[model samples]
Target: MGSATVLTSSWFCVLAVLAVLGDAFLPFLPSGTLVVLAVLKTKETADAPFLLGLAVACASFLGDVLLLSLARRGAPFLRRRLARSPKTAASVRRVQRALENRTNRAAATVVIVARFVPGGRTVLDLAMGHLPERSRRFLHWSAVSAAVWAGYIVTLGWLNSHWFNTTWLSLAVSCAAATAISAAVARLVRRSRQLSVVAQLDEPVEAVEAA
Candidate 1:
């Protein structure tokens, strides 16, 4: 089918929404790839990209909100489980402390950054429910994160479409590139967390030495 015909169809819209929404709950879902594929097919139409981006963004935001609400409702049970494991409880306490220490903007930035990290969105959203921040604040930042994520993926697909001749080639290249980027970001985040732990651990020793 032609780009316009495929992009304008009802099935496409439904599929796009489902892919984005499902990803919120199922981290393994290839929602980003599906979105990129959709954008790749929008080459012939001028308005298709905008409409698709908007729909994807709205669906993503809605999914985040729903996931957050579910997490909020289950927070008590989750807390109980976390408390049973000292390691897990400590990790939760650390995240809570970090979020509590940071300013609103910094915390929101963390939320936005988590959206791009593999499997980070689900974990972060769930943790936000138990964090000290209000739901309104999280929703606001999550909306921005959703929009940014949609735009980033859509733009990547659009650019790849112009760069490559074949749709499959564009999809493959873009997905590979996105995966590499996410891997690198995940590595950096892990490293940062380790360094923070090291610093925290050293603080007591340094204080003892000073005495």
Candidate 2:
């Protein structure tokens, strides 16, 4: 690939990194869509697509780590800030429990499967980071997840590029996919909250014997 082509090739990786970073601080960012479009544009070029994939993977992994670490570290401050409110604590506990139940193997499966599942990929790493497992083990799983995500998107793009001539279409489809994935995540959150409520209801309350 020529210099221009190489630069074009790298554009996807850059955008993917930005998506990861953006999603890190802002949960509403369309990270999944951006990653797909980026891969779609870069997959067919003579440029070194593998290099671009590597860059994207690294960026995503690091971004996830940063987000999770910050959240964990900032929890104390957040707890202090929301001290008077038990609601926030309950919500945090629910999120923590959901993430904790996802074992290393389950996380690996999620990372690979969510590559095409939009918001799922971004949340996977964040959830993984909150696990009680060793940091080294988490890193290993995260790296593998990133690589799998990149490879899946890149390969899909390469296959579709033959029939899809416009990058705009790729972006449009990615957006739609992201929207659907967001809906799915919303449903999952709702269900988790309901489950938490049910679990709480199962507890017994103490009573006084005499008044």
Candidate 3:
């Protein structure tokens, strides 16, 4: 068999397994890069594996949205535990301020766009959990954002499949690299958002003391 055929078959199997198992069992699977690589490989592989990409994307989108919904329903339980830890409360407060701002609609837009931004989804999900119970606006924006994210990643993967060139070693390395990159991005965004909130939180306190 030609190398491309072997590569194509192997990628199809791997993508299928990841779709079925990875998100639930392995948090670090780099599903985004896997999709990207799968699409990239389709240039020379078997029959443009776009269906696999779509399935994975839809699964991921559903998982994210479901998790967010669960978090929202379970907020009171979370808040009790979170409220006990000063650090947790502080983080929650930051997220709350961001979500409750006069430009909150804008913040929801960020949350939605962040879903496609590699590392932004997890943090945004957590932040969404802490928004006021009555804030349906955040939920609407989040669902729209999540849908956009799913379509964008799947489309990118389909378009870029020709670049994936599915070697086992290459796939392994790409997954690792994507995970690292996304984690680093998430950490930085969280820190920046936290700092911005801290600054905002201190402002009113400072104003009150001055008065």
Candidate 4:
């Protein structure tokens, strides 16, 4: 209720929003880092409810929506900025194939996990837009992805808070964990691209052998 608490929450909410929005296009940004920081700050204030996670999740969802809107308009500036290799393009096909199913479960899983994978979310979102899923379908999946991603990041910070009383130490550890995950994701994306190329190379050989 104090002015100090009000000021802190206000600034944190704004930062969280900005970070999420930035991450939608620019995967390298530390939006997850900012969300963890906000969680730590929220813990420091007793009166505030446990609304930090929900707020961050909502911000993340909105960011994806913004990108989706732009993409629908034929402005694929961000997607174009991403690496255009065989694997990255394959990644797009993977998403399209995932969404091709009538059921939403596979598509939902890809969307949610892509948030954790560095550079994956942008690729998936663009795929969804380009593949031209109904706006309603994309929004529904986006909500699910954002909620899961934000909750995971928020939980990491919250758990760390209990372990280290020092705010700086806790924030550093959480951020480090987030960074490690991102690195792993980047590696995974690379591996996926490699596999896709292998698969493509094998297809013609298999057809020749059969014929």
- TM-score winner among the candidates? 1
Per-prediction backbone clash count: 0, 0, 6, 0
Candidates' lDDT values, in order? 0.69, 0.53, 0.50, 0.66
The sequence of per-residue lDDT tens digits that candidate 4 reaches over residues 146-167 is: 8888778888988898899898
- lDDT (0-100) at residue 142 of candidate 1? 90
Candidate 1, 1-211: lDDT as tens digits: 6665864654655676698987766667788888888887666767777888899989989888876786677655455554554544454456556666667777787777777776566556555667635678989999999899888888888899999999999999999989887777656666674333212221111000000
State the lDDT of candidate 3 residue by residue for 102-207, as single tens digits.
3755565465545534434444454566565624665566557645644555465554333455555455555565556545544554466533432222211100
**TM-score of each model, paired residue for residue:** 0.77, 0.60, 0.54, 0.73
> Among all windows of ten consecutive residues in candidate 1, which has the lowest summed lDDT?
202-211
Better of 3 and 4 by TM-score: 4
Scored against the true structure, residue 29 in model 1 reaches a CA lDDT of 76
| lDDT, candidate 2, 17-108, per-residue tens | 68766554444565556666667766655654566567667876776677557545655543353354354334445545655665666545
Provide the global lDDT of candidate 4 against the true structure.
0.66
- What lDDT is reached at residue 49 by model 4? 26
Tell me the lDDT of candidate 2. Answer: 0.53
